[model samples]
Target: MAVRVLSIDAAGIDLAGVALSRLEASLRKQAGDPDACVADFFDLAAGSGAGGVPSALLFTRGHDGRPLLSIAKALRQLA
Candidate 1:
């Protein structure tokens, strides 16, 4: 048996109408509260020893009350 995983370079792709809509929908869902603060997530601490690490981290929330990206919805938008 064999397995394969598909991945996309999020930065390499351009987002437009449908994609933007999808992203907004995902952001809302992840935040739970629509008013939750949202910001671009990144992993600055990641070691430079490796390549291909995602340039950005998945949307996440802060303890102060924020929402992260709804990964599932983001993937769906790509599809």
Candidate 2:
């Protein structure tokens, strides 16, 4: 299985916890695997309480440990 890293901003809401949870569930559902971990990073400029922007990095492992798509780049497409 490949590792998928999804980075999301924590400033939009209290997404650090829930975002990763949702991502993990979604990935597991889609790939039928339960191998996923989340790494949260804080960006000093964008954070409210802190000096950085809180970001979440979700790592998901698929059957080949590779991502079928890059969710982060895909999000840019929405823009």
* Candidate with maximal TM-score: 2
**lDDT of prediction 2:** 0.38
Instruction: Locate the minimum summed-lDDT window of 10 residues in model 2.
Output: 37-46
TM-score per candidate, chains pooled: 0.26, 0.35
**CA error at residue 16 for candidate 1, angstroms:** 0.5
Show how many residue pairs clash in every candidate, following the order shown: 1, 12
Q: Write the per-residue lDDT of candidate 1 for residues 1-79, one digit (tens) a residue.
A: 4432223333433333234346546766786755422233222212122212221223345485443434444335445
Model 2 residue 10 lDDT score: 40
After superposition, the stretches of candidate 1 with alpha carbons farther than 4 Å from their true spots are 1-15, 35-79
Task: Give the per-residue lDDT digits (tens) of candidate 2, residues 1-79.
Answer: 5443334454544444455456656766766655433221211112334212233112223597543333343234323
- lDDT scores for all predictions? 0.37, 0.38
The superposed Cα distance between candidate 1 and the true structure at residue 59, in angstroms, equals 18
Q: Could you tell me how far off, in angstroms, the CA of residue 24 lies in candidate 2 after the best superposition?
A: 0.9
TM accuracy, model 2: 0.35
List the lowest-lDDT window of 10 residues for candidate 1: 43-52
Off by over 4 Å in 2: 1-5, 38-79
